[model samples]
Target: MPVGEEVREAWRADLDPKIQAVRRLARRYGARLLAADGMFAALSATARPEHWSADGVHLTPAGHAALAAAWLRLVA
Candidate 1:
């Protein structure tokens, strides 16, 4: 499938702040970036990777690639 705007939007809502902080770190070396809703929610709720995956251990290669590609967009 072609890369589309919805991919970026979903990543932003569910993943962008993490990616943005990573990008900032790449550009700023040791400097810190601001935290957002992710941290606020983390403080109030349990952390979860399963929320984003189908199973605890196994993930389809497409799923892995989609995750990797999202990060690659930030670094690239």
Candidate 2:
């Protein structure tokens, strides 16, 4: 199963660096990445195993498409 938010919350001190890496990727791509308290809260509440694979990780093709669409909407 994907690690639940409860467990993730317990390890946030460790997880932050990894999340920062995502921010770094956004910078490398010249993408605007905005992190907010509400974004984290919503993600914690709505993140699902279905978002990924049997290993409960990585974006599926549809996930990539959705991300692309969101970026398009923001940029356009």
Best by lDDT: 2
Stretches of candidate 1 exceeding 4 Å from the true structure: 1-52
lDDT of 1 by residue, 5-29 (tens): 5764675686767777686885789
Q: What is the C-alpha RMSD of each candidate to the true structure, in Å?
A: 13.1, 5.2
Q: After superposition on all CA atoms, how large is the RMSD of candidate 1?
A: 13.1
lDDT of 2 at 47: 61
lDDT, residue 26, model 1 = 56
Q: What is the C-alpha local distance difference test score of each model?
A: 0.49, 0.59
Among residues 3 or more apart in sequence or in different chains, the pairs in candidate 1 whose N, CA or C atoms overlap within 3 Å are none
Model 1 earns a TM-score of: 0.28
